[model samples]
Target: MKLIKKNTERGEEKKKRPKKLKRIKNANPSVVLDRHGNIIRRVDGTEHGDEKRGGQFLAALFEKLIPPGTKAGNKKQKTEMRKKPKRKAESEYNEAVPYDFPGDIIRSIKNTAGDFAGIIGGKSPSAGKAGEEKRGGIRDAAPIRKLSAIRRKFMSLSKAMRRIVIALSALFVALVSVCALNIWASGFRETWKAREASDAEKAALESILDEAFADERSEKLRPLPYRTTPAKLDVRAGAAVLVDTANGCVLYEKNADRLIPPASLTKLFVMYIVFKEVEAGKITMDDIVPLPELSWAVNLPRDASLMHLGQGQTVTLRELMAGLAVASGNDAARAVAYYISGTQEDFVARMNAECRALGLKKTYFVEPSGYDENNITTARELAEFARIYVTHFPQSIEEFHSLKSLDYPLQKNLPSWQKNYGDTLAIHHSNTNPLLGKLDGVDGLKTGFIYESGYNLALTASRNGQRFLSITLQGQGKGTKQGNEGRIHDGTELMEWAFSTFADYEPGKDTSLVFPVPSLASKGNDGKFVNLVPAWKNKITVPHLFGSTAKDSADAVKVVVDVPPYLYGGVKLGAQYGSVKYKLGEITLETVPLVADRSLESAGIAGRFFGTLAKGSLEKNR
Candidate 1:
């Protein structure tokens, strides 16, 4: 009965242990993890028992040639070793071997294993060569009889069957190699093409002049390509431009530099001044508008648009802005101007001051509401101002300009008017912007129609976070049948072309920057790293790839940061310490400047000494 019990226990132990691998034999000591018994990867990230490091193709090839038998450890001592705690030296199991490959030793093993494999496949091996070479403990240990047994067994088979198997194996390997090469080459080609821009593309990227900016020190922007205008686009306007604000690339332009009246687009600057005042806490959106007698509905010109701010009517700054933007009301603009400044003349001066401040060299205003045809700006200048305006006050687009219609004198604010007629007196006025809902993504912006300026629309739209700013001046429309035909045609055609042709590409998602600094080598700090920052906004407009981060389509566009491994002493603030490269896979698309976050100095005696060492190390890395 005791013998039966002992036999049963032995059988259970054999089942608990795994079956030995049929093809692999351990040539070196294999890892045996005690604490992490089930995890495939160890703490340092190398796979357990995976110490062999060499060429991938060679390693995979040699793995199959290893014989089945493995050298055994002392079974009794192996069991006892598990009870001992892991030592400091044992914990660094992955770093035990250096990362470099073994040269001659590995080559010798491959020769021996390769010859043995050749024999199995019916190819004759050079006699005595396998016996002459025994490399680094890996040997062809099989005797001569074993070779005879393999040859005889192989000869007993059908030769045609063996040849067919060999052909299939070779074909499989060839197919895999071809597939891998195709994938690699495809990515390489895209990167190469993106980096190699054509002569036409270079002409398209020429910089615009300082006229687009109000401030001389502001960041420069290129509105449109100087050359290579899109073919087949027939835009008939006195002046016109379509620009992507993300990378500031111009999609289309016609007489962009020609001077023309901005029409009601002048209200854009008035609203800009008001928003700036509001942000500075000088005024609030709820402030009661100081209504002047000249701004009254009865006093405004007969054909002019009006918000109907009648006697005893109370209006807030917010309501007037909505009316000014939505109705293109001359009364609302006059009242807003008077409320913000004492008189229309003073307010117009402020508008001109703001224009000059912004660098609108060709733009000046004599009146606030754009009723006067003499107020001037070019298509290119207006486009630049629109970009700055939208960037400065993004919320105004949704709050005021985007309203589809304006209902004047709401009962709550118009107590006197509402008390007389209640809700019946409130009049609905449609937004002056014609492109609002008729086209996708159209939002708030001002439009004007005067004999001096014809029909003008400073249009802006956004979809999926990509925004376009356009200025169309002097649309030729005399009657309802010809109503804003030029402006509408130019706006729709250019917008559709821009959206289809180019999209914004955001850069510098993850710099993946790593640098080492010698200790005590930096000013005011004892650490071994310095902080880094980008010198400019990480956005550029690219064709047909919109709203994508670098991680999404890395093959089309990626950002590579080349940071030095060590800092040689301290760095100055805003210095160009390294570079940020925008790449399409392996090829660089554009290179921008990268700067240090703060100033660093080699302050102390110890710092200077270590800084010298750091300098030597950094030079070697370079």
Candidate 2:
């Protein structure tokens, strides 16, 4: 090879020759042009046009041909298209993304990327030549297979949901059953609690009735028997009443408000109203009532009793009440009514109004004295009235009923005997009240007999702490005095039976029992250990119908614990304890709480050792 020389920057001679062209085997190329329609640059430099760069070079040529005014901006541009080499197997395996991506995603990525590229280049796809068509268009793979796989996964998830629903339902049912059992057991546990009892207290109250009913001279409840006159004691039908002084219960009753005759019992209600009036301060015992024109008479009728009220005579309200209750004076009734009401009819209206206000549902008064064709009251109604009157106004009996007579002088020396007119014989009247002196605890109420209603009696009495009222209506008796024998007999018998046959009972120490708690149903940390307690210590005293005989006596108290249902594992503590059982004459049982159980915590080894050492040290020091 010959040495070459070339001119150098140092002005030294250098040998040189034309430079050989550097051929690029696969080089991408383009053609450029200037204003003269001349190819200023031939980038590929090949006789046969290079497939890759030929289309790009021709596009650039046309861009430069446009005159400056032909386009929006005067500019000449150049373009080059480079072919992307195919990825070989080795390169494909080296990439993190495998060749086989799911078909759907690959197609979407290419389509989106191509659209973005075209917008930036400012050219439509059709502007690229046939050989460069692939560079401009995006390629995508089919996506049908990927869609099928997604559908398969959805079906699998739906199948699992049904099994989960069934499992949850079963769990819910089991939870409810456990709660129900816990509630049931808690109800019964309350009855097992214990109560303290004393023996001496029980015996003290046992004979309370017998001592209360005992007769004493100062007690003043002895009954007085009166002789009855068949001729004068005439009642087509009638009623009567007697009341106990102690608790104000009824002791005897007759047809107390039947319109038969104002034989005598009507005086009781009249006296009651008068006593009430005085107590209310409307009138005083000393207040005087003027005698009416028809008040007094001598030899008026064979059947009539004498009151001897002069037409112009004035008597105190107290004396009139005494004459009415003790003497059963007809004139006294007229006198008191006229003074209180200004007229007899008005006074009777007051009586009727009084009866209605007292809840005496069956009573009606047309007259103050309960005389014939006027006033009517049932035996039961009178007994109730007597009960209320005597109970609320206890002082009236002593003031009115105990009087032997109502004797007051009309003039300074003219003394007249008012005499006992409660019950009458053929020639004289006497008290007709059946329970007057015959029953213990009995006090003042009145008695009557008439043609219309028959014999009746109302009686009330008290024994121990209990009070009873008995009413007998239309007994086997007529108005005749002997006919009233039935009334007296029934009244006495009934009062005796009420006081003697029945007794009140309280729970004894031995008999006090409690309700039982169901073991499974009670609620607590441990259901078996906890119990419900009774809300109250109940006491019941039922009537003992049997007598005091060996057979009649009640058996020893029996306590039974009733469990309604079997307990379950999750039963609640303090559920219903069962009720205690007892007989009428026997004592009742009380319940109490069970004592608390204690639990101890275990100590660690180090703590236990120290505790033992401390104890030993303390003992040595002591």
Candidate 3:
């Protein structure tokens, strides 16, 4: 092949014909571009001579494309061009080129060369420069650099350590997930448990109501006791209360709502239950109750006061009650409870039920005997209970509570053991109540003592026509004997103070019938209003000084009438309708039930039809 050489110094091209080109063995291959810039293979298909001239031809072609004064050919010129400072004019001229054709072509050629170099040399020159740039960027700052160093160190470690780190990360994530699940589960479980507990409580209350209303005859009794708030008083007992039984008025109280242990004062409820049984005709006083094994066991304890009935002995209900009331016999109390309700627990439940029915809050009974400290009540509630007791079973007080003493198994038939220890095992058990005979007109009440409740008493007294009931609990004393004395002393002082400081007052006959409630059925004179009278005629009491007479005190007291906004027509004569409250200033002295003096019949069918029409017309117009 012949080669053409360029004479750049003289700026001329010279063509020289050489000898036939010799092909070199194993020479690198070369390619040529046609006028269209496409590669063309040699027609001879020989690579030997082409390899020697191919590079020189491409260099010469590139030199022809570049403009004059551009330094791009020689390596030393390239170095000098890079070191030279650019002139202002040249820089502006370079920026003035609208198209970046030369730079683009140069970049393309470099990319192509890099690709080929990577294939041949296993790495590109630009790749190393790019990695070095990345290393010098912001990511190479201290924090990131330290993190990268730690990563490198971790990678350098053995496989076991790397696995340990990965496992720990997994375990941490798993623990967080488990804790979250536990919190969610606990919340759901607590909410479900609370819901179940509320449901159970509702069911229990429903069952209690069912049992209480089981007997049809139970309807005959009052469902809820009347309530009254009176002036506060300072009394020297842990708890004290005074109530007017005839009218259900709470006259004076101190810590009356505080729950306290009742001790044997619980016997009052026992007696109340027994009286209910008697009224039901379930058992009579003369009826005999055989001593059960439980009842006989009462005598085994030295601390417990018993009726002294033997193991196989039988006793009349009357005798048992006497023992309960006068001697405060725990055994007698238990016997009465069991006899009436079949079990002491059942009887205690009955007591609590009755308490609830009577609207007594803060009262609970665990056992019938009240020996357990769990038997709890408030002074105000206990006084209310006593009022109901005496009002319903007046004979109980006279028959059993009034007795000064009683001889069980009578003195005539005393056994040799009792005779030998007559002083210690006396047949006569004196009434536990200290005020029975000591205070005039103080008939029958009960006294109680336990380690928990220092001393307690429920006392009733009457002077002339005035009746008063009082309770004193937790009286101060050093011992049981001293406690009993303190209770009696407090009771006496309270009674004396009440009777001396207050007098019973009755409003005049004209004022007694204050409210004339119109009957809904009444229209004409024949169906006139019914006169409502106070249920308690002379039951109102007031504080009085030494010189004050009942008349003067009654004049000072204010009478407030409270009647229903509307009264239905079909009313019975002498039936309680409303209440009359007596007050002195802001202090309420008493409240008495207001009753219908005359019966009012329901309106006839014709009257009712017209009445309904009239009522509707009035309502619509208003």
Full-model lDDT, candidate 2: 0.48
lDDT of 1 by residue, 270-318 (tens): 8899999999999999998867888888998898878787766788999
Candidate 3: tens digits of C-alpha lDDT, residues 1-622: 6688899999999999885533222211244445433345543353334333455654554455433454554545545544658645534544553333334333444455554554355443444544312232212233333345345444544588668766766786698876664553333222112211135534543454345333311222121132344544445679998765655555677887788888888988888878888889888998877666677645546787677766545578898889888888888877777788888788899999988887777888898777888899988878888887888888987898899998876533344555544445447789988888889789878887777876889999987767788999888888767777777777877787767666666665335454665455544543435556554343555666324654356457787878764355556655778987777666676676666655557788875664443443333332
In terms of TM-score, the best-performing candidate is 1
- Clashes per model (N, Cα, C within 3 A): 4, 82, 1
TM values, all candidates = 0.60, 0.41, 0.51
Model 2, span 1-622: residue lDDT tens: 4456755777787766666433222222354444433344555453333434444644554455444453434332211222356655534443533333233333544444554454456433333433223321232112223334333322233355436544654776687765654454343334344222224423332233225333321122222111212222232323444434342323333455553333355666777778778778899888777677656644234354445555445567776776677556677788889888889888888887887777666677766654454566666566667666766776766676644345543342121333233223112234556567667766545555454545555555555654555555555553456556776676666666555544333444444333222233223433332222232232222333466631232233344444333233332222333444554333332232221111113345653443343333333332
Which runs in model 2 stand beyond 4 Å of their true positions?
1-263, 297-302, 312-314, 402-429, 439-441, 461-467, 475-479, 503-542, 545-622
Clashes of 3: 1
Off by over 4 Å in 1: 1-220, 223-232, 410-418, 510-528, 545-555, 585-589, 602-622
